[model samples]
Target: MKKLLAMLLVICSTASAEIQPEPIGRIQTLPDPYPPHWIVAVDVAFFHMNDGKLIVLDADSDDPAGRFKGMMNGTFIPVMYMAETRPEIYVLESFRARGHRGERTDVMTIYDKTTLAPIDEVVIPAKRVSAMPTEYYLQLVDDEKLALIYNFTPATTVSVVDLEKREFLGEVPIPGCSLIYPLAGRAFASLCGDGKLLTIQLDRNGKLVSSERTEAFFDADNDPLMEKPAIIDGIAYFPTFLGNVFPVDLSGSAPVIGESWSLVEGVEGGWRPGGIVLAQGDASGRLYVLMHPDGHDGTHKDPGSEVWVFDPQTKQRVDRIELALPAITMGLTNDDDPLLVTTNINLEVDVYNANSGEHLRTIGNFGQETVFLFHSDR
Candidate 1:
């Protein structure tokens, strides 16, 4: 009887040891030939307020690899990828505290690019502009040494954070100006409400070195310039609501406003440059703009039916790419086979060959309204 009980115990132990439990999820190593281009799409949810997400897509394979979805206070949170020293991403967004309508806390969260794991977060004290997408609201300066965050708590200001040290330095007050365009050296330029360009020079510690404002440059009320400017070689080309291109030279100590040029000379009537990302400049010094026909007084926010490529140096139209669908926003990749991506009215990203202007493919359903398409290489 003792020998039988011992044999049964041994058999049970051996069987239990052989039947090892498998891991819940296995980590598989990826093969070679990874996707080349990466596309970052921001899904701005108006109905489900807390369901906004920053989705990352592989352009070559057209697959969504990773995404970050959370409660955000506003509609215009921005994400920036830092690919210099390490693979990391920075997102400037706000979160609700106790309740949905409770106190808001603004933060800059850093995430690992590979694993999509959060690394660190720095709290920002100032309230950011939440209504519209401000292009330069959060801009990196001095080769990622400092991070400039634009704030608008009924007053315009910029909060400078030392990215290298991972600390918030302080806020620089630009009373009447908004937006930030990093100039040469440790300075930045802002567009003022009074139709002037405000240039502010900041030291390493986020202190103001010097500040100056240019004379009233353009008419702000009737023909206000678009927020996103195509900056090339220290020159910012701003497109107005009336299809006028305004160039400002920021290479020197101050901003030098150049003569304004028209973008619609030979085109028929009721045509104007309009869209979220209306204008973008390429590496070859060519400018791409979205144009729409039958534009009215407040039609600057309308979707564009065509894309017009122009040589800003010669101020002449080079190529016109007609779109199958009206685009509200557009972006371009910096690869050899550059792709011109446009977000249509149905929130689908229509890809096209930038050189030949041939339609490639449409990538996205995203499960929400995608407002912007930012290329990693661009």
Candidate 2:
């Protein structure tokens, strides 16, 4: 097996331009005949202007090229959708919209990754997707199940599908604002959005095991202003734009909010939290949080990109690194060492040292793709 060595150090700079691509690690490049030890391959969703497609690239080497590529040329994909499966890409399109034949439709397409072939398609009920957002809305409960979050219709249900068999598992009614996430040994579905936070637990057998609700709303107190909670080791850490980190431990008899700490001191304007990445770093069983860009200006601009590292145990911010561009979807190598991979809005994919925010190498160009999304290294 070939190995890559990349060292990352906490580089503090007054400006974000100091970081550049430099060789610090070795990436094993695999050819047409994939080697067993190739380890991980990266997938990038390319939305080229009106034409959208998915591109799968191998990150084993600097010049390692894309293994699979497909195009949706004239096809229309919904906005604000997340693809959450492996070897397959799911795209939810518009409702009552004309397809190639001008037929009324609301459809989600599942494409095979290896062959770039259409495996199956799911048609959503017309009324369910007519809500305010008007986007093909859904969330992945896991690799298999998907919680369909639609609008207006109370009869709307979570459409669960068996990814392996490529069939519908079942549908369950989960009304209100709910965010579905894969956690621990099951799926964590939190119905929040409409003031109250109602959490439901789903077992591996596709059954509802238990349900709970928070008696209040997320406000200035208790660091309730965070976007969402990310769970690590059965513990959910909530980070807010107000610069507070709320740690909630759910491993006990009753879930309780454990510790709260201020991450950024007097953060001007507010701190907009981005993606949260957690991995076991040392022998002490400690986990770190990867925070995205934050600035004094109250803007959700694309260029506001920064990576902040924090000790989840202490709930304190330890290191901060600024990036050239902001990140959308990110992943980490599944090994003892840490290698951070991120796809940015600038249509570029970068490999960085997870511990020390150092840019090692970059792949691809962004001007070709209007939008870009990514999945974990598989």
Candidate 3:
């Protein structure tokens, strides 16, 4: 009896030992250079603004495990720009002295793509805009050597940062203008409150060289253009509160405001372009705009039901893409053959064939409220 009891104990011990512990202190690294379809989804976390996030994932991957590559957290409302020439990701973010609020602090964090770890940080003015996420709020110019940050301390200004030196270049004041659009060589154009395009040029040393404003291009109070614009081949395609396309040719040293065209010229059901990130222009200069029905007052920021494609040469919509779900924001992956990515009302990232407009795959359980999508071909 004693021998049998001892043997039972030995058997139980052997079984317990076979269960291996999870590997500890293991670090995983993503692909050095990610695939073309990989996108960084921005989670502004509206309900919980301080704890924001930027999720990087493979838009084309079917498996969820394979799709999610990496992520980084933000202290406050933040905007990110992926560097083309450098292996770094720039995040213009803010922090509070305490947990939620105290003294405010803003900084541009330089993160390494491989480790997804913040490698460097540059202190900037604490007056960064604290509203919805927009790529225009933060832009990279001067061959990615200088980053322009749009500030709305109620007073509009652009904070220039020397990317190579990692220092804060002087802030250029544009009294009534906001948003930043990279224009011809070392220059940026901003949309003004009085319906003008303010172009601010920078010297080789990242200093203000010259600035000018074009005549009133669009009606600001009546039918304002969405701050979001699809800049393709040196031209920005801005969609108005209605369904008009306002093109600003940034190909030259100064902006040339082109003629406007109605997108819903012959359409019905009150169709209009609306959403957070509603516009996208591909390498071929084709415009992809998010559209919906039953447009009304204050519905300019509503989610979209379809994507209207347009031919720049003809200034006419060529194709209309019906979405599987209502999308709040949209973006395009920069591949030889691009893919249109959109965030549905449920915060699921939907992938579609840019050319065919076919629903490829939908990525659910991505993030809590993805407000923006970032993907680049270059």
Alpha carbon lDDT of each predicted model: 0.75, 0.48, 0.86
TM-score for all models, in order of appearance: 0.86, 0.62, 0.91
Q: After superposition, how far is residue 195 of candidate 2 from its true place, in Å?
A: 4.8
Residues 96-211, candidate 1: write the lDDT tens digits: 76546677888777766555556787888847777556457777767678888888888889988888777888899998999988776678899998899999999989999998
The 10-residue segment of model 1 with minimum total lDDT is 67-76
Clashes of each: 0, 4, 0
Q: How close is candidate 1 to the true structure, as a TM-score?
A: 0.86
Better of 2 and 3 by lDDT: 3
The superposed Cα distance between candidate 1 and the true structure at residue 200, in angstroms, equals 0.6
How does residue 345 of candidate 2 score in lDDT? 66
Q: lDDT score of model 2?
A: 0.48
Ranking by TM-score: 3, 1, 2
What tens digits encode model 3's per-residue C-alpha lDDT throughout 1-378?
999999999999999889788988999876657788888778887888788888888888999887888888766777988888888888888888887869888999998887889999999999888788888888888678889999998999989899999999788998899999987678999999899999999986768889888889889999999889898888888999989988889887778888898888988899888998999988788999999999988889899999999997798889999999999999998666889999888888888999999999988876556556565536
